[model samples]
Target: MAVLKPLGDAEMDERQRRMMDAMLVRGRDYNVFRTMLHHPAAMEAFLGWGSYILSDQNTLSVALRELAILRTGALRRCEYEFLRHAVIARQHGFTDEVLHAIAVGDRTPLTDEMAMVMKAVDELVVEGRIAPDTFERIRSTFGDHTAIDIVWTVGQYSQVCMFLLTAGVEPDPDVADDPLRPLFA
Candidate 1:
């Protein structure tokens, strides 16, 4: 159960309904977004930043970005984030085997680029900073701007997982049985 109950469509004010409608165009009324509607102002700001993070403006490939996000969710044990992003991750070409490997901290068979990104996520999640060698690798492969974006991606998703866990947010009913569930468990 969520610590804060999600507001249903009927329960929303006009502004909140519009926001929910806009979000629905992209997907369903995810419980996290619905719960966020309880505070309209904060939800507005969150939507903007969240949009940019998932957009092409972030410089990282969608695959890399989702990889970092999945790792963060697994590390934090945030089922909502892990399950939700797992769907998107699959759309972006992450196979089930790769997703499971990420959840369990296995990096074998991944491309050098992906392995480095996973290593960076691990270092950031566990140590709060990327080691120098990892930092150099990221910078060299993707450049300084992307290096920053990678870190930002990891940090942003880390915060998201923490919020979902702390709020006790529930996964959407449809995704509750996501295959990734047991990995997190």
Candidate 2:
């Protein structure tokens, strides 16, 4: 069971009720939201902003965005984020082969643009700084605004991973790992 009890259907206020409805429609009975119910305002703003990014963001398609998100999750070893995004990744056209490769930080077959973005993510996460080469490559490929969006997107998901892990959020039960080892390991 989750350390924090979920907000039961009967317990939610109107705002939470709407968020819960959206979560259910997205097939996410999220343990994070359950825990965050302790601070409903934070949960409301956080989830609302998150929905906007996933649904209304510019600069990247759903597939590319989810790829960056899953990569950040895997790098952080945040099981909740990884598992949730792994499912969404597939829905957004990440083939099993590509998914497995990404789990291990292999960005093979990525477009030049994606590879540069992934390289920036890898450098930022692992080395605490984007390498000069990665910076140049991405800047050249994507221009200023797009490059900023890619980096910020990775940073945003990284923060989500940190929150989910530290807050003791549980992974969705419906998804399963294939080749990658369990993240919590």
Candidate 3:
């Protein structure tokens, strides 16, 4: 059960309602969003930054970004984050084989670039920073801007994983049958 009860439409004030409606327009009514509505101002602030991180404006490609997110969630054992990003990973064209590899921290058959990103995520989660060689490899391959985005992407999702776990957020019923559940279970 969620430590913070999610706010339903009928319970929202005008500002909250508007924010919820805006999210609905984007075809998402995620429990995270609904639950965060308990503090509308903070949710609004998060949405702005979150949008940028998930947007085309971010230096990382969607696939690379989602891969980092998935790995972070799995490492943290945040079931909600793992399952949610599993879906996003699929949408970004990650195959089941790749997803499973990420779930278990197996880099088999992945290109050097993919493996490096996963390594970076692990380093960040475990050491709070990527090693110098990994940092340089990422910078050279993806450029400094993308390297920074990679750090931000992993860091942002790491924070989200912590929030979801600490808050005891439940998985959205709509995704109750998420295939990734068994892998992380």
Candidate 4:
């Protein structure tokens, strides 16, 4: 069960209702936001930084950003986070082959440069810093700004993953597909 249950419409105060109405995920209030509405001020603060990483301001292509997010979520074993990003990734043209590779540690599904990027996310998650060689390669390819964006992207999603897992947030109904894993149970 969720540590803090997501508030239903009736449970929300006017302020939370307004926040919920404004903070749509996939066009509806996701459980993450519903749960987060318990502290609207904090959620509002999270939104600004989250929006930047997710917006065009970050300078990483949507595809590259999603790649970093998917890796961080998977490495963290954050089912909620990984599944949601899986939806975004597919919407942006990530193949099932690539998604499965991320879920299961297979690199064959990615391009060489893309695989290197994922490796950086993996190191960042597991080691808290990308190794010097990986850092140099990414800096050379993506430039200083984008290289930092990759770190920021991973950091953002990883924090979200921790929140989801720690709070025991459930997956939204709209984000239920999981070609990234499993078949008939």
Candidate 5:
């Protein structure tokens, strides 16, 4: 179980209550919000912008986006994020083999475009800067705006992983074998 109790749809403060209602009507709950509820204002601001990024406009294909997500999740060893995005990656056409490669942090199976994305993420996590080659490759492949979004997406999820770990949030049950779970266990 999560160290913090998840706020139920009917069991939130008025502001949160409204947000929860909106989320439920969309047939989902923001697990991130449930954890971020301790700071309601931050939660609202984060989710407001986050929803826009994830839903309002994204140019990358779902497969590419989710691959980037999974790669960053694994790099951070964030179980909750990794597990949730694993299924998303699958839904977006990543096979078990590809997901497994990401889980184990292998970059060999990735296509040129995917390799460029993973290389960018690896450089950021390991060195805090994108290498020149990877940057140019990403720029050539995705252009400036999409490249910026991809970096922000990875950074956002990196922050999410940090939050979930520090908050001691439980893994989403739907994905039982998140690669990070073994570390926590």
Candidate 6:
């Protein structure tokens, strides 16, 4: 059960309902977003930044960004976060084998860039900063724009994953059929 339960439509204030309805219209009424609506002000403020990080505006490729997100969730042992992004990663064309490999640090199936970025995610999530050498490697390979986005993606998603894990936010029942569920650690 969730320590801070997600609100149903009826439980929301006018402001929260507006926010949630916007997502519902977009087919993104996920449980974490619902749980976040408990603080409409905070969630509203978070939306723009969240949008940027997930939007076309982000310099990193969707596939690679999802990889870092999966890695962050994995390092935190956050099932909700990892599993949700696993589905998103698949939609972006990553295979189940690749998703599992990213989540569990099995880099053999990943590209050099994918493996390197996942290692950077580990540094940010577990040690609170990316190492200088790794940052240089990222910058050299992907350029400054992407290198910075990787850090922000890992840093932001790590915080969000911590919230989901600590709040004990249950996955939406619909998530049960996701292929990643079987491989969740």
Q: Give the TM-score of candidate 2.
A: 0.83
TM-score sort, best first: 3, 1, 6, 4, 5, 2
Q: What is the C-alpha lDDT profile of model 2 across 4-80, one tens digit per residue?
A: 66678788888778777877797777777666776778877887667656765547667778878877887898877
Output the better candidate (2/6) by TM-score: 6
Residue 130 displacement (Å), model 4? 0.9
TM-score of structure candidate 1: 0.95
Q: Pick the candidate with the highest lDDT.
A: 1
Sorted by lDDT (best first), the order is 1, 3, 6, 4, 5, 2
Which model, 2 or 6, shows the larger lDDT?
6
Alpha-carbon local distance difference test for all models: 0.89, 0.73, 0.88, 0.85, 0.75, 0.86
Q: Which residue ranges in model 3 land beyond 4 Å of their true spot?
A: none
Looking at candidate 5, the ten consecutive residues that score lowest on lDDT are 176-185
Tens digit of per-residue lDDT, candidate 1, span 1-185: 67888899889999999999988998777998898888899989977888888899998898889999999999998889989999999998889999999888899957888899999999999999999999998999999988888888988888788778877899998789888787766
lDDT per residue, candidate 4, 95-119, as tens digits?
8888888876678879887888889
Residue 4 miss distance in model 2 (angstroms): 3.0
Full-model lDDT, candidate 2: 0.73
Clashes of 1: 0
Of 1 and 5, the candidate ahead on TM-score is 1
- TM-score for all predictions? 0.95, 0.83, 0.95, 0.93, 0.88, 0.95
- Model 6 compared with the native: what TM-score? 0.95
To one decimal, what is the Cα RMSD in angstroms of model 6 from the true structure?
A: 1.3
User: For model 3, how does the per-residue alpha-carbon lDDT over 82-156 read when each residue is reduced to its tens digit?
Assistant: 888888888878888898899899999678888999999999999999999999999999999999998888888
Candidate 5 — which pairs collide? none
lDDT tens digits, residues 1-185, model 5? 57777677556788878767777787666576666776788988888767755863866667777877888888887778777887777677787778878878777888878877887888877787788878887889899877877777787778788888878787655557654457435
Model 6: weakest 10-residue lDDT segment is 176-185
lDDT of 4 at 55: 96
